[model samples]
Target: MTEVAGSSNSNNLLLEQFKDICAVDTEIARRFLTESNWNLEAAVHLYFHANDPEAIQNDDNARNEHEIRRRNVANPRNEAPANQNAVVRRSSESQLDTWGAWFRALLALPFRLAYFSLREIFLFIYALFGGNALAITNPREDLQKFLTAIANYPNSERINWFNGTYNEVLNEAKSSVRFLLVYLHNPSHQSTETFLDKVLFNKIFSDFVRDNNIIMWGTDVRTNEGYKVATSLHELTYPCLSLICLRENRMACVLRINGMHEITPVLTALQTALAENQRFLNAILHERAQRELDNRLRREQEQEYQIALEQDRAKLNERRRLESERQDAERLAREEEENLLIKKQHLAEIRERLRAELTNELAVKGGETIRISVRFPSGAKFDKIFGVDDSLEKLFNSVLVHATCPDDFSLVSSYPRVHLQCAPDWYREFSSVEENFGGTKTFRQAGLENSLVVLVRDNDA
Candidate 1:
């Protein structure tokens, strides 16, 4: 079941491809390809061959027969039996039509002759007045070809015509800031030749057209381009003239003159239209200029706003940078204070250990030891035995190392209140210590032995 369904889908896709290639209806393509045993090449070959003349003729004959049968079935009246009387009626009607055609032609002969005579007279008058008859008859030619033919005609150089498309002429008029005169000609019209010869070709009118900054675009109504313009502008007469100008960025017809008119009135109408539309064009230019100025001001304001925003951002970044530096400085100061406190605590522990060891050594040498009582800033007291041989500098170093505020202190004898300078190098020599405290006096003489009270005071006090 699956295989069968898949094959069916593949065949459908192939049929669509064949339809696209041949540009034929899907059903017909499928039927023909199926008849060719699903062979694409054979189906295409048969399809083209079937379009041969004899095959097409046979197909047409078959279709006609089928249409006849269908009509007979649809209308019972068409299916009626044919008779000899009906055949005779059809033959008589054919003969009557043949006679009626001949009689109508004969009756119209005089009117036809009069029409041709009038046309010939018109042509003769046109030639006498230096107009070209051939040019009038071939009005459907291209604009350039038509204009060139007119220029080659007898005395056609008297009229100065602008040679360009309608749009091209309008653009030129806009660039020069002038008005455009568009003339649509219908050469087939009876009055066309007379109007051209008498008004357009006159010396005064031609010179006026040439001297003015106005552009003139001419077209024949019979040409495709001319017909389109005429229909769009709703022109209803031959030899129509329009004065067009650019106003508010669009082409506007200021005035239109239809049918025959004298040269003086046409020129007056053109001049009036130009004057009115020129004011409108000036107003448009003024409005455009004001709008441009407003746009420039708006752009400048936006640029200033952008600059202000950038400056504010820069100031904020600088403020943040200063704040970060202050925080780092505070953090470094705190770290240094903590490290100094830890160093002082470590020195006190080492001093306590050294004091205990020196006291034990002096106690073991009983007679050779000297005992001293020391008081701390916290009012704590301890007794230590020191060898008389121990330098005074060792005693001062131990006191300083144990002091909480070691950098700001002095030691004094409580009774005399004498300040002591414990210089490390000088007091480390036994002879210096002996000279300052023991040389002039023995242990009992200077009252310096045994135990003594000492006070620690702040250096500032």
Candidate 2:
């Protein structure tokens, strides 16, 4: 009975494996596997070949016949009368399907047993050398499935089981300088069930592992990771436990439990292992904490230095901007001053040339002399002799070229204070000095007699 049960289990295992490889539904895998007389190799080859044109034609023909039969059953008018040959053919096909099912049931067990035995032999030979005979394609998939199973187990959620590859969990524990407790579980072992029920699934043990910060990573011995762990630790006993700690830069095993034991012995061993390694773990943790603190301080100092450097740069940039503005203002002031000086020099040259021309103009010969005394608003008086032929314009020019003359002024008789410009010229009304005596060429023509006094009033003043 036990042998039969084992064979049945192995056959189910093979069926699941076949389903995974072909990525097909259970019914479809069973159909093909049964048609191949439960020969996995023949079933797989036929599955691949089933996609060909001839096989597809056959499948389509089968579906068409099934559809026709369904339609004839639904519509009585489409039903055809059965013949003896058709009945015989249908009975033959039915018998063949039944025989195929019986063939699978009978043959699958022995095939699965033979295959399992051979695989185990190879696995044992390879495991003896600390290596896996079969490589797992998706290691993480297996790990995730194992984690899910443990999490769903009764009272197993409280236990800390690292959900990663064995090496990953080991590296993490070593990096954190924590004590690593590894368990290699054997699902087929009789005592494994007891160990899980009483020891690993207990709340007290869970709390103990958590409070001590112990990392527990476990795997099934039948899995790729567990087999590797079993080989590396050189321990094959079911429900094995190995306690490891970082010592001299390596994860060295300090304690190991070879077989399933009661909760007390496991707990006592764990407590003893943690006690022995407490001092070493503390020293490593203290050194790591000190290093982290130093790094944090260095980072803070670097941040402050960067801030100070930025402030200095901003100040330098502001100084440069202010200096640039100051230089611009100074340059503009210098240019304005130079331009003003040049304009004044040019005006002085023009005035000097006008004075020399007026001097020669006033010295006209062989004409009646007219003495004109000019009185400025500043109480300054000047008597200038001029010929009758010397135009009134010449008289005005003599005052204009004087050093003390105003830029704009009008002339009038001092006695009556009557100005000759009663109605100012249209264009030159704003410039009285330049147009005071327009159209009157000589003093007599202007109705001015000799010894006349003219008052020069400064318009701007």
Looking at model 2, the pairs that clash are none
lDDT of 2 at 445: 72
Candidate 1 lDDT score relative to the true structure: 0.58
lDDT of 2 at 79: 23
- List, residue by residue over 1-461, the lDDT tens digit for candidate 2: 01222366666775776665555446556555555656676666666433212222345443543333233223222122321111111011222234544555455556556655776686698887988555554657667767876676688878868878888988998898998888787666555677788878888888888998889888776677666787798664456678888877788787665444466656765686678778888888888899999999999999999999999999999999999999998998898788656655654565587688865653546757788898877777788888766567666667766777765677788776667552123315235355443565566776666677888888777
Models 1 onward score TM values of: 0.38, 0.53
C-alpha lDDT of residue 429 in model 2: 29
TM-score for candidate 2, please give it: 0.53
Full-model lDDT for every candidate: 0.58, 0.65
* Maximum-lDDT candidate: 2
lDDT of 1 by residue, 1-461 (tens): 01222377777886765564554455556655665666765665555433212222335443543333233223222222331111111011212123443554456456445645765687699888997633442333557765965665456787767777766777887766677877777776555677677667777767777776667778866666676677766664556677777777877776666555566666665555566577877776677678879999999999999999999999999999999999989889988788667665665575677667655653336556566566767776566665556555555655665645344455566766655544344222221122233222222333556666666655533
